[model samples]
Target: MTSRRLFLSTILAGLTVPALARAALSGAQQAAVDRVTDWMKGLKTLSATFVQIAPSGALTTGRLWIQRPGEMRMQYDPPANILLVTTDWRLVFYDGTTKQVNYIPVAQTPLGFLLARNPDFGDEVLIRDVEVTGGEIRITAFSKGNEDQGSVQLVFAEKPVELRRWTVFDPGGTKTVVTLSDVRTNQDIDQELFVWRDPQLFGYPDLD
Candidate 1:
């Protein structure tokens, strides 16, 4: 089954940044966006684990691979049978149970719109507030009308913008927390891995 961690991690992790330091980040919200942007600007590729969790307690984990200027692929673990991939112009999902590979033009997805029109990390999703405690940067994003149209909280590492964790809360109160670990950037990735293929033909379309 999918680990529940990977699904939301990949999308929510892309929460844009906020306005210029009006005052300064005494805590997380201010520092995180700047730190993450600084770090990402120096790299070319990013890979990590992503997750999504349902309130019922199911979990899904996927390999989160990202290529700069907009490219990513998240392949869920066994049994869950779901894959979310971005091939520049498309954001595709293959559902095993449905035996259908559903794809939407990147222009249509809320997340896609964020990446396509604002990949620079500027103009954050809009920060509702920021607080610092102990050693974490805790930032809450704007309301539903914000960039990604969701409310979220991001926790930044003490060192910099390397996001340690984040949570996305939908209008209905459903929440997904994503924890990022073993982050590596500038690694070479094979181009073939991002392409979409038929699960029926591959026998494990879910894995493909």
Candidate 2:
């Protein structure tokens, strides 16, 4: 796979864990997880400008729009020529340069948990580690039986409990970090942003 495709699969496809034994959580860890879960459940909508550092150390900027229960759009800045959208049940990846489109189940992505109407961290996800430091909370997790696929570390600010960024580590140990800026939450986003129209058939429209 190309580096761009690799990064997308690592972030949105490889992290699915179908069935596995649950890991034990300490009292403090469980409390932290509860707080994170609550924050996720309350997040109805979000819009942000993001800076993504790929595994190759290449940097790209984009705008992100997300609505809960399963919808997201990531429109990369020009020269990157990539777009990713999550439909009701699938994650759609579009390669603007090649006009290629790919689809994968939404539940198979690490972001699925965040998009789930009721995010559950118990059986579907494994909490490998949790760190609280410098007024930040970081949760590192992966699929229980699918740890070889990769893991995602979600970073959040403490005082206000807002998501700031996430690092996705591929199987080879390379990591892609995406940091969010100018984040606005609980704001209305245009529903059209999440629509997945075939770029090849319908031609690409300005979804930005």
lDDT of each: 0.58, 0.79
- Candidate 1 displacement at residue 60 in angstroms: 1.7
Model 1 residue 205 lDDT?
A: 31
Best by lDDT: 2
lDDT tens digits, residue span 135-182, model 1: 776666542233434456767666654556667665455666667677
Estimate, for each residue in 1-208, the C-alpha lDDT of model 2 and write its tens digit. 6746764654674553233424467788777778888888899999999998876777989898889989998888888778889987798888877777778787777787788878878666777778878988888877767645767888988778889998887776778899999999998888888888775677656645
Q: What RMSD does each model have against the real structure?
A: 5.5, 2.6
Kindly provide the TM-score of model 1 when superposed on the true structure, using C-alpha atoms.
0.70
TM for candidate 2 is 0.89
The residue ranges of model 2 lying beyond 4 angstroms of the native Cα positions read 1-4, 16-23, 200-208
lDDT of 2 at 176: 85
Q: List the residue pairs that clash in candidate 2.
A: none
